[model samples]
Target: MPANPQAYRPETALLDLGDTFWDPVDAADFPATTLRFRNDAAAAEVGLDTLSDAEWTRHFGRFAPLPGTLPQPLALRYHGHQFRQYNPDIGDGRGFTFAPLRDGAGRLMDLGTKGSGQTPYSRFGDGRLTLKGGVREILATEMLEALHVPTSRTLSLIETGEDLVRGDEPSPTRSAVLVRLSHGHIRIGTFQRLAYHQDEAGMRALVGYVLRQLYGEDGDDPVRLLDLVVERTATLAARYMAAGFVHGVLNSDNINVTGESFDYGPWRFAPTWDPAFTAAYFDHAGLYAFGRQPEAIHWDVMQLAASLRLVAESDPLIETLQTFAPRYQAGIREAMFWRLGIRRFDDRRDHAVVQAVERVPRATDTPIDRFFFDWFGGHVPADYPDAFDELRRLLDPYTPRKDRDHPYWHGEPCSMLIDEVEAIWAPIAADDDWSRLHAKVAAIREMGAALA
Candidate 1:
């Protein structure tokens, strides 16, 4: 007999950390709850796919508590540097951690909401999510996951019957509530808040809780933890570079302690290999531009190290921070080679390949996605530019893994360019036509499978 979906376990691990890290809040009373999109595949992993539409809406849309999980939604507290400026005023303003569950593999994961309601951190703005924004998030997560980025999975998106006015995009837009599943909601900012308040005990407690709940480890060694976080962040940065994804907001608070990418806003994929390609228009200085993502991520990791000083020695934490550069370089080398389907020969050849990857795309003005698609599995084109001679030579020894057999590779490469994004959203905005959205997601998944 098939196992019952409700048999999956729920966890209250975050609650044991105490109320200092969060505030209890009630979900907003929305005018209507219409399920816009449901990730049944993700639900199946967590044994929630068996729920009826009304049950799913009640749990995710209406924020009903799961048994033995979150008795109430929690607006988590933390401080972050927004655009490099220290800001103690930020937290989960319009969202909260709803509950935690164990997947089929018995790994702990969290279900958090965006634009669910207002909390103490809501600031002066009304707590609501524009439906367009939610749709964009769906697109971002789907594409990023297809590209193998360790990211939060979009579990559900429910359209709430309300009109929201926003500065960006068209005004009087529809609203929504988005649920995402990630390792856990705890962020680097969670540690920053404790460090800011000089709460050493709180820092220790937080570290212990994170090691147990998030990492599934017993020790709370901040130095060891920082090292692991640095490694993961390095890998994340490298993956973003290989995928040509610009996160737009690398704010310290936006980074999770688990090193997974979340909080999609003003994100964009590079059309070309231009280093200055930026996502958010407000990034006047290009602080979080495509090329500077590694720097931005490293800077956030440094702040995390600073936070760990409350419980660990500075020398050891600093030592861990130094590893970010080398680890990031290695990560980039591995990611690029994997995406290109080339086998690493030696240090020199790998270094040359990485340099060629950086140089060829920029010099050729090739769309980053097209470049990867064309050169996949070392299948260098016969008419390749003279500048690519060294790269082609380096790839000569490797056999092509992807012989362009995948249907997706036989045609145009799948990409998430800005204009394409606008085109996809236009029909949805005009007539609520989600057909294009569904089709695009299917295509992206096909591309992912091909790349894999």
Candidate 2:
């Protein structure tokens, strides 16, 4: 019943392409109110977000007036390797891609919502998401942005006047749907679904669609597409390691085929260097651990490759996958150096920084949060001999004391390291002092120029 339809395209480009289940229009059945609204600069780039509220509800939302904007209601279909085992019945269980929209910066982004109630894929479950889930996602996205990691931004959160049940927590809990602006919603499982169905044409069509939508400038070579995906994914993995982030659920269904970070469930920043740190309660085996992220990324990429084989199996695709390890390592190293605040890595200084921080015996299992917070305030200990001496002093109380030999204190310092680094980088992280840092770096460059 909306007059304009073109305005919704920016929001419709990212919808799942499989099945559509229409929501019946009755104000009582689907009473909605906007709780929060966010501007997704990433999504805006894709020529989306032009739709009016009525148009948005009509095309993306179920309860609408005339013929729906989208030709049909669609849910994405995909399979995934959950915790290293194949799970075929997983797709968008509680969420769906609405459409893509261009933001202020003109970047095309997916405007998708989580907890927007059920579809055929709901699988006899109450298709609702908790407010806590929405809160966690917002925090994770904000933190990732501050830490310079590429992630989806929370655009809006709408509390639907409904109660739903979930297996993890109490039932009859309040529910809210979250709209996130992301690069693309195409997941690795999407390809797998087509492969499992032996739909080569569909696979090819999907691949072509992704290439045009995300990497149109790269031309139409499927091998090139494979190479780019591997490179981007490898870089993303390295960034994750550098930031001490562990994506608890790295199932194929969760891995965005566009190589963007998607599905923020049970994700956490490391407190220590434990290769086995996991955020998901169900991940008893720690398949998506801190140290194993790179390998896990490779495994996911391989799954994508396998799916691609349904269309074309070639040496080039295999070769592209093989390049993942080296690229991943390089990306990790670069990201680590950046986080450590060492403009250039001098083996001596880098080791000294690492050792000095590691040696400051932690006194408690106190989180690394305070140390960084104090350091960002330019506070260091007088006892320590470094630029961050004041910060070290501030961190001393939290440092593990020799008398405190609890398990909590043992590996806590490693966790503190990231916080400490973030503290040192906070000025830059805040970006308010970038001009000054830039000027200082420039002055140093000038000194080198005079020396030369």
Candidate 3:
């Protein structure tokens, strides 16, 4: 890697940009002649700093700065199973780790680049990323974070000075590299790789490394490590279901061992509970639909536990796997209750909530996105009159006529709180006044505090 210029160099921090395998000459495969750098807010929370103009071009490509600072680079290496098969040939192909940053809470975060350039893991294809793909990732991270899911944050996107050819869509459209910040990048497949090679020492080393990096050395019991991963996986899976998110690809490579959600590709949030809804075009079999995520996560956990056989026994591992289903269900119930603003968790109420959600038309199905708007905008329809008169008017248009007679109407008063929330968030989504948006968010935070 090249050294940073004096003005761009950090005085106390180590300047460790560029991977050991990075090759600037491989820029030939990219249609874009230059790459640009941008800051990611999510990455910033973890303490990432953007690179200076000269440093960005020298390391990332000849791309210019896009009105943001560039952070130091940090390359990450991990093994993962692709499509259930162990593959040792995977790690930051077109992307490399940018630096780690500390957030307001002092949590260490890693900033990484996607589509920055090519590395040894590029395989046979160009390591460039598409602008559309970058945009989708930004949307995924932003939306998922707002929904309170354990997800990687999309920090920034910089359009390259060139175009790239792809098999899908146009031959040469615009290209970009996205920066994402997350807890850790280690994956379940990372252990699987060592297990497949019968490298017990490597597996042990990797596990120890993970314990030190993510859980601290004091919490390094093999069983405990396995259990933590299982528990976190269950919690994350439940959160995904609550948020209506489908990862589209749950391959081992995409399963972060640290339990943080990573690698957002072909992901989607469902508008309804269709078990077969898929986000990836290539997921023809629906193996990774929204409904299958929990099961897929269980399978991935089993694989991770199996890889730990070198350090522990199979019986205890299988026992850990058995705990996944119940744990996932419990977590899902809790998350759903929070999302719906339910104060109590009763089986009957849970059933009612599910039924009510099923009956409510999706945002895309009608003008429901604006339902709360109309309600809070001070117009109340008479047909669905109730204590939540405003909310009833908002939801009446989306409710089917047949289910209008349900007893769920008893809980109608809750709609006032929901309406208030919508009123607070609507302007933010519309890109209304920034000061007003901040005030609204503050108000929402206060509401959350009051609820607590």
TM-score of each: 0.97, 0.70, 0.70
Better lDDT candidate (1, 2): 1
Candidate 1: deviation at residue 295, Å? 0.6
lDDT of each: 0.89, 0.59, 0.59
* Candidate 1, run of 10 with poorest lDDT: 1-10
Error of 3 at 77 (Å): 4.2
Pull out the clashing pairs in model 1: none
Top-TM-score structure, candidate number: 1
Backbone N/Cα/C clashes per model: 0, 39, 20
Question: Where does the lowest 10-residue lDDT sum fall in candidate 3?
Answer: 5-14
Worst 10 residues of 2 by lDDT: 20-29
Put down candidate 3 lDDT per residue, 273-375, tens digits, no spaces.
Answer: 6667887898888888878989888888888998899888888888888898888867776665555443434665554544444344342342222232223
In candidate 2, position 449 carries an lDDT of 29
Which runs of model 1 end up more than 4 angstroms from their true locations? 1-7, 401-403
